[model samples]
Each structure stands twice: as structure tokens, then as C-alpha cells.
Target: MHSDGNRKATIARHRVRLAACALLAAAAVLAGCERGSQIGAGESTGGPSGCPAVLAGAQAAVSRAEKKEVFWNGPTTGPAAAPGKTIVYVAQTMTNPGVAGAANGVREAARVIGWNVRVIDGGGTPAGIQAAMSQAVAVRPSGIVVGGFDPDSTSQQVSRADAAGIPLVGWHAVAAPGPSRRPELFTNVTTRVEDVAGISARWIIAHSHGRAGVVVITDASIPFARHKSDLIRKELATCSGVELLAYENIPIPDASSRTPQVIASLLSRFRSRWTHSVAINDLYFADAAAAFRAAGEKGSGPPFNIGAGDGDPSAFQRIDDRLYQAATVPEPLSQQGWQIVDEFNRAFSGRPASGYVAPVHITTAGNSDGATTWDPAGYREAYRRIWGK
Candidate 1:
């Protein structure tokens, strides 16, 4: 009898272990389902594959927010986003071609869907962006486009919009990670900094023969600067001939006095130890590229490979002239900008969220001569259908 009792207890324990294993397996499957993508413009709406993870760390908190809860700043009704009501978008800064392209995309979308859009320039400053948000609040627009505003300052404006039952969409970068008493933003759209950064890093590694040391002149002052730069560093590690010797962030409030001086110092340092440089953009990092070329010991590894961000024509010109090695082309802001507008309409209309992961194409010697267009006729048609005449 004793032997039989012991055997039964062992059998029961084995059954319990098997059940635990099954539960763990089920949880693993659920986790994969939860890891979703960005809700984009065209095609299927809100599917996992096509979504781009934008404003992830911050936006994650929104899911934990009370779905039925409302705030106390703006309106209680988002009739602008409601069916048959016009939706208006206001951009804080449409000065740069990139920004204007974004506005153009948004406006075109509004026209198709019979929505509305309004834009104001925040001048790319804290006060400037804040004022733009303020004006947007006063206009009581249907929706908002954060042209170049920081989150810390934009948070209050977002609160005001949220309270009024308006959905705020973000474009490009946010104000980095900070503690705010407000809910995380709901930017139907934002830039893909990491995607572009990875492309840029891969370019650097491939060009440098897989083994080289370089200086990273990243701009840390900008809220999203560290995030992009950090990703670049990680990707670079995977490349063969790349080592980030040192990274220095320049905070020059005075562009007049410090710009040249700062670049000059960076050049001096790179001249001594490393043979490469990577910067965040054309103008700022262009200064360093010029310095390194001038100071580089003659005939040292393809003139010390230097690259920057932005697909702007100026960066292309430098790449052509071979003054700069390469720069990522984040082009046709109009295409993606309008795509996000389409997203809001789809959600409000109860249509599936169309998703897209634009190809992260590289602009290199292979495609240098060819006319590279980021968005095409199909893009225009999509915009027209969403916000038509």
C-alpha cells in the first residue's frame, strides 16, 4: 500500500509540471501577438507586419491609459474627427522644404477626405513651437501636426488638445523622454530615425572596408539626438571595420561664434587619432567634414570617410563632390505626411488601419546618377483619394 501511494504522488507531480509547461508556451505566443507595428496610410489597416514602431517608449504608456477617461484643457468633442465634420491640420513650421512637403501631403489628404488642415511655424525653438501649439489650441482645429516641437513644451498643448477631445498627431522627432503629468501623445505619424540611422551606419562600415576607427560627432542637445545616435552606435558594432573612438555632443547656443570654432576643434581631434567622422546632419556635421579633409594626413583611407544625415540636396551635392562620404536621404516628406492623415480618417471611419513600411533605400554610387524619387504618382493618387477636391 505504501509503495502504491508513493507512485501516485510522483505521477501527480509529473502532470503538474506538464501543465506548467503548456501555460508558458501559450504565453509566449500571446507576447508575439502583442508586439505590433505602426498604423500607417495605405493597404491593410493596423496589422502587425506593416506598422512602424514610432514614439514607442512613450506611446506604450498610452495603452495603459484609461480608454474612457478624458482630460481638462480643450473641448469635450472631437466632432472635427467625427464623420462628416471637416478636419484641419496646422503645422508649426513649413519653412524647410521637408516641412512644406509634409504640409503639402497633409493638405492634399484633407482635400480628398473633405477634412481640414492649418499650419503655423514654431521656428524650431521651445518658445516658437509652444506659440504654434497655443495658436493651434485657440483655432480649435480638428487635428494637429507637430512640425518641430519638443514634447516637454508640447505636453501642455497636447493636454489641452486631449481635453478638448482632439487627437494630436506627431511628425519627425519628439521632445525625448521626460516626466510629464499628461498622457503620452498620439502622433499618428513621426519620422523613422533609427531606420535612417541604421542605413547610414551600414554605409559607413561597408565603405571603410569593415575595419576602421571613427569619431562620432553626435548632437545630444536635441531631444531625439541621443536615441538616434545610440542606435547608430549599436548598428555600427555589427559592421567589420568600425569602432567609435569618441562621441562628443556640441551645444552651441550661438551658431555665430561656436559653429566654426566647435567644428575646428573636432577636426583637430580627429586629425590626430581616428580617420573617420559621422554627424547628425549636413550643415552641422558638414563643418566637421570640411575640417577633417583639410587636416587629414594626405592619402589616409579615402580621406577619412565622413557622413551625415538628411537626404537634402546639399548633402547629395557633397556626396557627389566626394567631400562627404554619404548621407541618408529621408525624402518626400509629403508622401509619409499625407499617409498618416489617411490613417486618422481610416480609424475614425472604422476602416482597418492601412499600414506601410517604406523601403529604407540607400543612396549610393549605384543610384547616384538616377533620379531618385521617394514618392511617385501612386502616392499622389492615394493622397487625392484620402483628401480629394
Candidate 2:
């Protein structure tokens, strides 16, 4: 009787083990289904993409933005240049490549329009910018340019310029690309931030096959940039397979010094999980390149980087060389510069703002044609024709 009871007990234990094993096997199958690239009725499942439609949309948008040959779509008819006018371009910093590029465009347009232009470097500080604005107002130029900085930051100076009836045209001075009333800018020149932000995020989605561990870098100090980063984040969220690993806010001025350390810490933390990076500006990747190299990351990267704005010459070079950066949503810097001068001319003539916003374009080594800058075609001649120069 004792032997029979022991045998029965052993059979019971075997039954329990088999049941548990069956349950675990079932669970493993379910988990695999959750991560598998299988399409069910009205549902998509995949490690790379849980929403195949969203991924497809992103891929299509990226393809559209990556096309070359953006033609001049700016103002073809505007007031002829008010001759012999002197303008002061008060820049946030000459060190900012976008600001400097626009400044150069302004210089070139001024030459064409037979005007004198002077630039004051604000040195990217509040007090310094205020001082520069004060000097700008004191000199009483025909117009003042709020170059690559917020006009509201210098409200007093802006008010002074407004009171003095100095027309203020801005290059990325406000969120949108047209006249600003409260801040009293004649117009703000930039590609629509929504378009830029959308395309940049879509690039990551398409490139990664809808699955990416992304880190976003932005300067929260500037409202425009902060807004841009927010839009990028929102767009990226549409893809369920994409995981935003981190949102990093390093000021543009501090990027060079801080980005390397930040990259090192992030490398240690995320390691292989960190597969892509999107920056509001291209400079962050430029700063992070050496750190990535030190970490033994390939130049052709797992952490593929794309800049949302300000596709400077260096950014193009990085992309062309297949360095740490993969692509950029470039603002047509030279064309916008010419537009600024044209806008100022219209303001001088008491006409309405042109309302011409340049279409957004993306640049990669594949389509850059060995170009350092994404200078759109026909803007120079178009602006000259408008100014009757």
C-alpha cells in the first residue's frame, strides 16, 4: 500500500509540471505574436511597426521631402528697392551659421539693391542683444533685422525700434514665417516649423523601418526651437514601434562643450538601445561626433543623426562624408536672406508683407550633388527682378 501511494504521488507531480510547461509555452507564443510582423484583421503587429499605415505615410512623406530641385517660390513682384537705405542686421550671434548665412544673403541683396548694410553681433546674450539693439536704434538705420533670435526677448528695444518707426524684419524671429503684430516685426522669414518638424521625424521613421530608439536634442532656451522639438516629438509618437529614449535640452551656445559629455553618459546608459538621434540644430551632432568615435561607434552609425533645422555647410559635409549625421531639413538660407531684404523693401514702401514662405526641403548625401549648401535655384535672379536691380 505504501509503494502504490508513493507511485500515485509521483504521477500527480508529473501532471502539475506538464501543465505549467504548457502554460509557459502558450505565453511564449503570445509574446512572439505581439512582436511579430503579422497583419491581422484591422490590426498590424511587428517589432519594427505596430502601425503599418503610419509607417507607410511617413515613408511617402520622406520620399517627397528628399527630392532635389527646389525652385524659387518667393515673391516675384515687390516694390523696387528704396535706394540709398542703410540697414542694421542685429544678429543673435555671428557664430551661428544660420544667422551668418542669412547675414551674408542680406549683404548680397543689399549690394544688388544699392543699399548700405551693417551687422551688429549680439553675442547671443540678453544684455548684449539689448545693447546691440540700443546701438541699432541710436544709429537710426532705415530698418533693423532681428537675426535668428526672439524679438520678444528684447521688448524694450523692439518697442524703441517700433516707436522710432524702424521697420523690423526677422530671420527666424518668430514661430511662423510672416508678419508678427504683438512683437511688431514686419515679417519673420523661415520655412514652416510644422513642415520641417514633420519631415525630420518622418525621416527617422522611414529610415529605421518604423522602429527606432530616438534621442531628441533641442535648446529649450529659444521658444522657436523648443516648439520645433515639441512638434518633432509629437510626430514621432505616431509610430508605435518608435521609442523616444530621451529628450535632451542643451542650449545652442553650450552645445559644443556639453554635448560630448552628454553623449558619453547616454552611450553608457542606453548603449545599443540608442539607435537614432534628432536635433533641432545640426551643431549638436557635430559636437557629439568625437564622443561617438571615442565610444567606438561606427561613423556609419547605429545612432543615425538628423538635424531638424539650419542645415549649415558643415552639416552637408557631415552627411556627404557619411559621418555621424545622415540627413538635414535645410532652410534655404541664401534665398531667405534675399527675401528679408525684399520684405524690408516692401515695408519701406508701405506695402503688405509678401507672405512668401519657402517650401521645406531635405538634404542627404544621396541627393546633395556634392553641394555644401541647399541654396534653392532662381531666388537671386527673382529677387533682383523684383527689386529692379
Candidate 3:
């Protein structure tokens, strides 16, 4: 009887061990099944689960796009205060539309990046610019943005600014031999003046059927005048019988001596002989276009081709009135200011302080169904998508 009882007890112990082994295997299978479902879902959704590295980079790029109406490339965004930083923008340009346009860009850029800006209008004199820069430097601002100023007069101020550890940026134009001028003050942004000139010349040539003439009105004091004037001549050189009748430079605030009518009269004389006409920037074309229309000459002389470098509302109005023809380049002043702010934000965030060019294009009545103007609002949503919204 004792031997039989011992055998039964051993069988019972074996049965319990077998049951525990079966339960352990089932739990392992269920856990593995749950894990597999999670992996599969993450892959399908392309969310946090499937490819985390790729998703993270894509999200970052999307944030960089902003809400501003873009005239140039890239959306404008309100960057959170990345780091403690302060910057001062100094245009220091006297009454020049090009400078004004640049200032507008700088202002917009500042608003985006959250920086302070100090605008100084530098009359067509080096002394004035020097004084303006000196005053700005005295405050020891983080950085200064100058609009194509010749630093000769501002040498002392620039040197002082460097000593004080302030950085400088040039907008629109930089001093000649710019590299040597201010190693400390590097980086400049200007619309592609040559590109605009090329477009102007080509439009004239196209409108004239290869017969064209040029009358470039410019401000001799501004750096843009000579550089752009040279480009006009170069591009016109590409077409036969296309000639520059006169390259005139009229000073701002002194247009009284050379009224738009007077300039127009000068151009009119050449128009009778040549089939086309053009100007260096907005003022030139606006005035010339007015002169031609007031004279009751519509398409009378070579399509009255003119190129406006900055697309101001007044310029567009003139275009709408059919007082002007040819193409106008859109350099939204507000958008430029916003880009400056964007760059500043990057620098403050310890990213590259690399300079960037905001892309621009030629806007004409043809592009907008003969509207003869650019209303950025029509494409605001699209602009926001690229620039910021």
C-alpha cells in the first residue's frame, strides 16, 4: 500500500509542471502578436512609429515656412525667441526708392525675427552717411544694415563699430572691392539689377520686332545707376539696331531742374528716331511713360518699353493707366523686411549667418491678363504657402 501511494504522488507532480509550461508559451505568443500589430500600424501611418527620423526632418522644414505674402521665395514665419539677441538695422539711405525698398525689406525681416531697426536716410553725400552711421554705432547695436553706402566717409565709424564688436550687413549695394572695404562688414543683398536690365532690354527688343532704342534715366549718385546702366548697355548690345539713345541720371529732390516733362522731351526727340525706350528703375519709367501718354503717343514709338526695378503701387497705377509698357519686377518691400528678420533669427539661434537672396520675378500685364499691375493680394494664400501664412 505504501509503494502505490508514492507512485500516485509522483504522477500528480508531473501533471502540474506540464500545465505551467503550456501557460508560459501562450503568454509569449500573445505578447509578440501585440508588438507586431503596433509595428505594422506605425509603418502604415508614417507617423511617430514607422520612420521617426524622416518624419522629424519633414516637420522641421514645414515650420520654417511662414505666413507672410511672399514676393520672394520662402514663407515668412514668426520664429519663437530662439536666444537672447538684439540687432539694429541701418539703411542710411537718403531719398532713393531702391534704398526705400531695401529698408522695407529690412523692416519686414526684423518683424519676423524680433529685432530693432533704425532707419537713417543718407542724402547723396558721404558726409551725411558717415554721420548717420556714427550715431547708430554710438549706441553699440548688435549689428547694422547699410544700404549700398560708400564707407569712405564712415570709415571711422565702421572701425569704431568693429572695435565695439558690432557686425554689419550691406543691403542693395556694397562698397567697390567690397571684400577689402570692410571684412567686418560683409554680406549684402540687392535685387539682381543686371537681370532686370536684361529683361528690360529684351522686352524692348521683342516689342519693337528687333528695332529698339534706349534712354536710361538714373540717379548718378546711387551705386545702382552705374552698375545697372552698364548692364542695360550690355544687354542691348545683344540685339541689332538696338541702341541706347541717352543714359540720363537725374538727382532726387532736385528733379525740379529736370522735370519729368523735360526728361520726356529729351526722350521724345530720340523716340522719333528710335523705336524703343527704357529706364533704369521706377522713377525713370514712370516719368517717361507719363510724358509719352501726355503727348498722346500710344505705342507711337517702339512700344514705349520700360523696366521698373521695384514694383511700387504708383508704378503699377501708371502701368494700369497704360502710361507705361514692358515689364515690372516685383520686389515687395514689405517681404524683404521680413526676410531680414528671418536671417537674423537664424543667426541668433546659432545657425549659419549665411546670406540669402530672395527670389524675384518680372510681373507684367500679360502675366495678370493685361491688368498692367501686380496686386499681391490675389495670390496671398499661395505666397503664404511659400513665404509664410
Which candidate wins on lDDT? 2
Q: Compose the digit string of candidate 1's lDDT tens values, residues 1-389.
A: 99999999999999999999999878764552231211111112112311122223212322222122222221112212334544445454444445556677777766666666666766656687777778888887666666544455677887787788765555554632111233444443544666656655655554444444566655565655567678778876764335687776754233324555665675455533354556654444444454545554232233344343445555555555555454344444556666667656654655544534343444543345633334423665544534432
- lDDT by residue (145-193, candidate 3, tens digit) is 7665555447788788778867666665552312234445455554566
Off by over 4 Å in 1: 1-101, 107-116, 174-184, 239-241, 251-259, 285-309, 329-331, 347-353, 370-373, 385-389
Error of 3 at 220 (Å): 2.9
Off by over 4 Å in 3: 1-87, 92-94, 175-183, 253-265, 289-294, 299-303, 368-389
Looking at candidate 2, the ten consecutive residues that score lowest on lDDT are: 35-44
Per-residue lDDT tens digits for candidate 2, residues 60-154, read 88878878877776668888778889999999888778889899989988889999999999998888888999999999999999998898899
Question: Best TM-score goes to which candidate?
Answer: 2
- Against the reference, the lDDT scores of all candidates come to 0.52, 0.86, 0.54
Backbone collisions counted per model = 36, 0, 25
What C-alpha lDDT, on a 0 to 100 scale, does residue 70 get in candidate 2? 75
Model 3 collision count: 25
Better of 2 and 3 by lDDT: 2
